[model samples]
Target: MADGAGRRVDPDVDLRVPRDRREVAAHPAAVLGAIAAGGVLGALARAGLQAAFPHGPATFAWATFGVNVSGCLLIGVLMAVLRAAGGGPPLARPFLGVGVLGGFTTFSTYAVDVHAALVAGAPATALAYLAATVVGALFAVWAGDTLTGRLLSRGAR
Candidate 1:
């Protein structure tokens, strides 16, 4: 298969080395376990990121917004690659989606952001974030589907 640089690699075996990238071909069980592990780590990381930046009261949830958007992007890529390969989820989907991304990006925090925006009479910001999150996440999902659909079809042919 070709890599990001269009370099060829063996197709018979997975040679991905990065611990994170290894999930690209990791055993189903290991993938699930890693997701479980990543979940704990992501949760702790979220708390840490939130606590480390305590400058603003209710107006600054940039961390949550950033995390959610980033999570959406990462999941989009991972989900595309995995599902493109027709891989089983057993743990992959749950680990990445439910465990890691979900933990990293707290909807509770998002709700707080929305509530604060309204309380501060900035309904536009709140509405925007809500619309952005929903629309952006859905776009990410669709993008993943489109890319993966193409990849899978190519592989099939």
Candidate 2:
């Protein structure tokens, strides 16, 4: 059978098939460790950015916007590379794609920023920021995906 990307599926290695608990735990431990390490790095980077560009309720949160948009873009590129390569090292997805990006993107912070803006009598700014962040992140992700896919396709040729 083939997956959504048309990659051949190995039935023997399928997750749907029941496996020994020990076997599953042993392999996933390393991937979890990689994710934990990557998460630390990603979170620290995000914290540094937030610290350097601290914004108040009345001010626009440029730092959070940049982080979320850039994270989205990088995720798009990462996904493209992983797909193009039929997936990379086992830990690569868990580490970079999940742990790093997950840690870096701040949905909770975004929500708080919007709430703060509204509370500070900047409803327009809050609405604008919300719209811009969502639209910008979507566009960035699309651009990253297209660009990476094209580059990889050309390299393949």
**Candidate 1 vs. true structure, TM-score:** 0.61
Q: Residue 110 in candidate 2 has what lDDT?
A: 96
Predicted candidate 1 versus true structure: per-residue lDDT over 70-120, tens digit per residue: 776766666556645444444565576657776787788788778888888
Worst 10-residue lDDT window, candidate 1: 4-13
| Residue pairs that clash (backbone atoms under 3 angstroms), model 2 | none
Candidate 1 regions with alpha-carbon error over 4 angstroms: 1-35, 48-60, 151-157
Q: TM-scores of the models, in the given order?
A: 0.61, 0.85
Model 1 per-residue lDDT at 130 = 79
For model 2, what is the error of residue 80's alpha carbon versus the real structure, in angstroms, after optimal superposition? 0.4
